[model samples]
Target: MENQKLILVIGGTGAQGSSVVKALSESGRYSVRILIRDSSSIHATELAALPNVTLFQGSQDNQKDLHAAFTGVYGAYVNLNGFSIG
Candidate 1:
C-alpha cells in the first residue's frame, strides 16, 4: 500500500473535483480517491483511469458508503450535493 497521503475528493468526477484531482496527480505527493455515485457512470469512468486515482462509488447521504470512502484517508475535499441536504 502507498504510504503517501490520500486525498478524498467528494464530487471528484465533477468540474472542481476534476481540477483538484488533476492538480494533485501532477504534484506527485498525494494519492487521490474519488467519492462518486456509480463506478459505471461516464464521469466515474474518466476519473477511474487517472493515474494514482481510486474510486469509491457512493453518495454523501449514504453514511455507510461514505465512511468506507473516508477509510484510511488523510484528508478530504468535500462539496456536498445540494439534494443531499434536502
Candidate 2:
C-alpha cells in the first residue's frame, strides 16, 4: 500500500459499489477500504480477498463509523444502501 491512495467505499458489498471497489482495487492505482455491516458476509469476504482491498465493519448511519471510515481516506464513494439505511 506504499504510495497508494486509499479510498473509503461505503456500501462496497452492494451491486454497484462492489463493482466499483473491485475495479479500483484491480487497477493498482488505489487501495480501498470498505465500510460494511458484516465482514463475514460473502460479498464482503470476497472483496476483502482482493489485493489492496480491506474491510471495516460498521453502520453507515452511525457517526463513529463514518468518522472511522473517513479517516486516512484520500477519497470516498458513498453509495448508501436504501435497504440498510431506509
Candidate 3:
C-alpha cells in the first residue's frame, strides 16, 4: 500500500464520482478512500468491497469528518452537488 498513492474521493457513489472511483481503483496506482453519506448504502458497499478501497461515513458539511477522511491522503477529488457560487 505504501507504494500506491492515496486519494480521497468525495461523493464517490454518485454518477461522476463513481466513474472517478472506478477508474482510479482499477488503475492499481492509487489506494482510494471515499467519503460517503451512508456507508451501508448498496453503492457504498460495492465500492468498499473493491480492492484497495475504503469508505468513510460522513458529509461534506462536516469539517471534522472531512479532516478525518483527508488524513494521510496524497490527493482529493471533490464533487459538489447543488453548490452555487452565490
Candidate 4:
C-alpha cells in the first residue's frame, strides 16, 4: 500500500460489513480499518490477518473511539445494528 487510502469500517464484524471488509482487503487498493467491540474475537483476528487490514477495538457510541477510528480515513462504511442499538 504505497499511497493507500484508509477506509474506516464500522459494524465490520456483522454479516454485511464483514464481506465488505474482506473485499476491500482483497482489492489491494485501500487500507481497511475496522472498529470492533472485541479485538480478540475470532472474526476480528481473522480480519486482522487479511492484507492491508487493521483492527481497532472500540464501540461506536464512544466519541473517543469514533474519533480514533475516523482519524485520517479516506472514507467510511457504517452499518450499525438497529436491534443492538435498541
lDDT of each: 0.84, 0.91, 0.91, 0.94
Better of 2 and 3 by lDDT: 2
> Could you tell me the lDDT of residue 39 within candidate 3?
93
How many times do residue backbones clash in model 1?
A: 0
- Model 1 Cα lDDT, one tens digit per residue, 1-86: 27679999997877787889888887878999898777898878877787888888787889899889999999999876577558
* Model 4's TM-score against the true structure: 0.95
Q: How well is each residue in 1-86 modelled by candidate 3, as lDDT tens digits?
A: 78999999998988999989999999999999999888999999999988889998888888999999999999999988765312
Q: Which residue runs does candidate 4 get wrong by more than 4 Å?
A: none
The best-first sequence of candidates by TM-score reads 4, 2, 3, 1
10 residues in a row with least lDDT, candidate 3: 77-86
Model 1 spans with C-alpha error above 4 angstroms: 83-85
Clashing residue pairs for model 2: none
Residues 1-86, model 4: lDDT tens digits: 86988999999988999999999999888999999999999999988999999999899999999999999999999999999987
Q: Which should have the higher TM-score, number 3 or number 4?
A: 4
Tell me each candidate's TM-score: 0.86, 0.95, 0.91, 0.95
Worst 10 residues of 4 by lDDT: 1-10
Model 2, runs deviating above 4 Å: none
